[model samples]
Target: MNHEFSIESRQFNLWYGDFQALFDIDIGIRQGIITALIGPSGCGKTTLLRSVNRINERLGYVRTEGLMKVMQKNILDSDVELAQLRKQVGMVFQRPNPLPLSIRDNILFAHKLHTQSHEKLSRQDENNLVENVLRQVLLWDSVKERLHQKAIDLSLEEQQKLCIARLLPVKPSILLMDEPCSALDPKGTEAVEELLWELRGQYTILIVTHNMAQARRVSDESIFMLMGKLMEHAPTDQMFVTPACKETADYIEGRYG
Candidate 1:
């Protein structure tokens, strides 16, 4: 219930039909900090991230129990407005997926949705929004001259940056990135990492990654999961150096996944 907490989950459980994916998970994420979720494949890292934003609610057999909140509002409540909640918390996926439209339109699409019902943005306002967010993601310089070009025509890394740019125009308070750098090359990964660091002051970020080095580089706090359970959560440096749990220490030391 603390206003400083951006995300909090209490006794959260998730199931897909007869299979239970997450079991009574409790976690809290502070505002304006990067929280990294690290775990081996099939350990439910991505599931937890998706649930935070209610993306998993789309699955027919998927059911969740307990409380999950963002900015002190209950996300699991049926009466909540999902559209508005999603605007407060945005997500970036493992692969880059840009719309078939032009670069300018991709960023404009969401802005139009959120702003249209209130008041339409002037042409100059729209242009400034697109340019500003692109610059924030460090893609403006390269794509400034080609704002009208098709989004699909850009390189993979550029497309990914554009996706991040698209989210920024809406001004979400929390950003969920699920293996965002997995598809990028070394240079591209570095660029995304730098962008994440730069965004720390403005947005609360939670990243799910298998790469320990990436977690250490961009995260202030770390949460480790295994077999659909939280093993440990601590400051990033301490989690890597002096993990409190034997399982966490063994996993980080490469003894076993």
Candidate 2:
């Protein structure tokens, strides 16, 4: 029951009907640090992130085994509410998917859903909340004057930042990012990477990325996975310099994924 790590997966296994996606994944993701999950396609990087938020269960045939805990709660428990879990663990997808609403509304959307219904969050309170989160994601200055604009109208980088901003008002402890910068150009990628640094130590971030350089730049710790199995987990510097496993070394050297 201890919240030992921001997220803990002990002997976790996952399957899609007859096909297995993950095999006995055991990892202790330290609190408030960025951990990168790097692997080739179909290596279950995204599957692991989705599992923390129970997004995999949306599929009828999906089944899981072993313990997967987020903030000390076993999310696989039948009694756990998806909404409550999601409130504690937010996810940013590979693409920015803002609702078809104004920038302000996009930021306010989750706060409204999770807050007590009877409590009237004053207009000022809502405005403050929006501004605070926007600032957290480093988007306040650029979009501050365009709060009423539709989120879709913004540049891809801005929309991605807004997606991250929206998650903050919910007070999430864990942030799961699945290749969050894949859609951005070089400049946009750099901007978001800086924002990720800004967010470090404030929230536990688990990012799945194909870009090895990006992972090395943003993550304090690195986890290498291959063919649905964990190859190695180590400090970012050690992982890059002296990988413990041959598979890891191969992957690091740009060999077969």
Candidate 3:
């Protein structure tokens, strides 16, 4: 399927004070598809992901240069609202990290924050929102009877799905996942992988992963990064079957990390 949204970065650079983390990098992420960033640790995969959502700009002494645009809006622009950008592009971390509240409250948190922007959602609207997103993630059946229970009470996999559910109420245009399945067990990983496929039609997804198999399974396009530079990027099947770069081939063939 073709993407409806587009993301592009040109000569993007990132630095943590005197230390540079990302080299000047250029890439484009097609909307409505899963693009996976794969590489060894500290190679700037996460940094690139953070830059897409402008998360890196929040750090003190961190500086960015060049241009980053999402859906034609320049995210690097000074006038851009980081909060609003974050709402349009939601993120999911490696760990569950659900709030210390009831399941219902967790899903409603984003809605409550922007209450004035949206008409006051009646209880039924809230419930429908929760039910729809939960079902999309295949978690509603498991948690429906326990909506009032503490979020911490759910299983680790269920908690991760709940976090995903929380993002849906705000209707984000893109989903950024940073090693979302790294903390999961085999079963939990499969759950998240299945959820990703289910969500591809509704939102553009960009994921950073160290798991090559996971990338092969879930991503339409795969990007390989090494030492702060892009090594190779291609359709998932082609990349794994015939990597264009030696480093990418080595990594995928289990020759080296």
Candidate 4:
């Protein structure tokens, strides 16, 4: 079952002051699949991921030319509301950055911010919302008993999962994860990889990772970028077995970054 493109970038160029970070990037990321963006450090993989949700704009010096569309709406247009756009596109950082609040409140925080009627949400409504998203991220069974515990007190893996769960209440169509496992141990990485599989077909996930092995394990499609330029984007198996570009092959072979 093929879904429509969740994100499309056409002739997209981004610059941080005089230094350009992305060059004419063009791709259509399909809905409901995990797509991995891989490259060496400073290769602009994160830059492109940040671009999808317009997070790069937070840096006042940054500028862009061309188009970036999320959910078929051209987000580059000035009329697009940042809050609504962010609600549709969620982002997770390299390190788990759960709020200092309790796990339950962390999950409800975004929903409360986006929702106009917090007082209207009954006691049962909030509890149901918390349980639903926690289960979605597979954190329910483990943290169910301590829903009100400080989110930071949880293990790194639990914190990461909570970060993901917190986004669900907003009903984002696309999730931009930048090295989500970079801060985790091997076991934690594996657990999150499993979570990614569980999330497939429900949310379009674009993840950036330096670990090619992780990319191969979790991604349906792989995109390799080099020095701010996209070298190749193809099915994960094909890209690993027989990359169409020498740049891609060399990078995968550890010959170059």
Q: What order do candidates take by lDDT, descending?
A: 2, 4, 1, 3
Residue pairs with backbone atoms closer than 3 Å in model 1 (clashes): none
Off by over 4 Å in 1: none
Q: Over the stretch 70-123, how does candidate 2's per-residue lDDT look in tens digits?
A: 988899999999999999999999999999999999999999999887985999
> Over the stretch 1-257, how does candidate 1's per-residue lDDT look in tens digits?
77888999999999989899999899999999999999888989899999988988788789999999899988988888888888888899899989999999999877777775668888898899898999899999999999999999998889888888898888999999999999999999999999999899799999999888999999999999999998899999999999999988887887876
* True-structure RMSD, every candidate: 1.0, 1.0, 2.0, 1.7
For model 2, how many clashes? 0
**What are the per-residue Cα lDDT tens digits for candidate 3 across 1-257?**
22354678888888889888888788888878999999988999999999888887778788988888887888988899887888888889888989999999998887687668558888898899889888988999999999999999999999998888899888898899999988889999999999999999789899999898899999999989988888787999999999999889989988877
lDDT head-to-head 1 vs 4, winner: 4
Tell me which of candidates 2 and 3 scores higher on TM-score.
2
Over the stretch 59-123, how does candidate 4's per-residue lDDT look in tens digits?
88999999888988899998999999999999999999999999999999989989886365887
Could you tell me which 10 consecutive residues in candidate 1 have the lowest summed lDDT? 109-118
